[model samples]
Target: MLYKLNLEHILFLDIETVPESETFEQLDDVKQELWEHKTQYQRKDEFTAEEFYERAGIWAEFGKIICISVGYFTSKGDVRNFRVTTFHGAEAKLLKEFKNLLNSHFSKPNHLLCAHNGKEFDFPYIARRMVIHGINLPYKLDLFGKKPWEVPHLDTMELWKFGDYKHYTSLKLMANVLGIPSPKEDIDGSMVRDVYYNNGDLDRIIKYCELDVITTAQVFLRLRNEELLSDNEIVRI
Candidate 1:
């Protein structure tokens, strides 16, 4: 099925998010209460809400995307290049830029958005954040009333599952087992919040996110039984 689709028609992406504020105390009393209630099941008396705030970035309501790195393939004859770019800075501003990119470039019915665990995480998180910012949903991101088959989104994690809904796979695990290079170097998802909030290193986060995008595109190619991209084939802009 993957071989049937043109690689250029799919936009591969990864996002880095952090809690909206630096600390739990930054959230007002109402939000603090909601946070505690929202995470009760996940926390399960193991940690207080304040202690668990480090993970707030996983939830769109409590988090904001700091970077969105996207990559896409452009093939010329036998040669293929994967070009990646990142949108960073303020959440609303970056989201608007991302929405514009989707609306202008990837609005075609055949153009799909691809990500690892996207359906479960990245895709919905982007949509939810866009709505929160009052940004109109681009055609690619808006899924309202669309039949499952009509949704123009692809998830590598879902593809890896292949039918076992009970199974879950992290991107690193998938890359490792597939012999694709690991994207992680200085930090991982667990450290993104601190990297952004404490270290004040947006560039580092952007680099990490872009690497994930490249890795995701590589994983997709591997799944399609295609050749992996070489270092020279990856161009970041």
Candidate 2:
């Protein structure tokens, strides 16, 4: 018998990244040196990893974590149930803990991980960082290795292709178009590094991550209702 997808098996996640701060200036120096060394792709204002680290801040600096947030949705019938979890801490430790949590709490091996543009950014970022921290990735994230339609993935941006991929759209824009209330407000991905660096407010970063997860969930619902759902009903988890 063919198995049906269960509501409990869907996980929606998001992440925020920033450059390291302590080595900020040192990074800039390295960038300048490298730019001087490389003739091609070099310019008067061109920056190296070191320079960018100094100017833009490295992802490892500014407390390490940046932010990681996840959303879980369980659908029953006309209402969708939602729960969110967020983590903020040193980059290495937080990522390790996040991996551990995934392994211990949600390691069913059958769960579907969902995110907007996740295949391109969020998922790969997490995997690469986890490997850097000496942690094993809990699941396979190599979408490129799978057949175009066979990959067990969903990107809201991809769904918009039904409309001819008309204009590029963001999660925030999609939520607005679908009448879904976005919790992002004034905070956005671009402001994440500054918010964590300048204000040192981890709470805001956590909230910001939560908002992205929630927005992603909303987008998932919109797509399900329009194309996947057999009826106009949301099942509460």
**The best candidate in terms of TM-score:** 1
lDDT of 2 by residue, 1-237 (tens): 012556567778888777555454544565545434542343346755444443332223222446688877556676656777876677777887777767776666566677887766677777777766777666545454567555555566766766674556788888888888656366877777777777877788777777777778777766666332222232322
User: Can you tell me which runs of candidate 2 are displaced by over 4 Å?
Assistant: 1-4, 28-65, 75-80, 142-152, 163-167, 226-237
lDDT of 1 by residue, 1-237 (tens): 889999999999999989998999999999999999999999998999999999999999999999999999998998889999999888999999999899888999999999999999999999999999999999988899999999999999999999999889998899999999775578888888888888899898889899899989989999999899999999888
Q: What C-alpha root-mean-square deviation, in Å, does candidate 1 show against the real structure?
A: 0.9
Candidate 1, number of clashes: 0
Estimated TM-score per prediction? 0.98, 0.73
Error of 2 at 11 (Å): 0.5
Candidate 1 lDDT for residue 191: 88
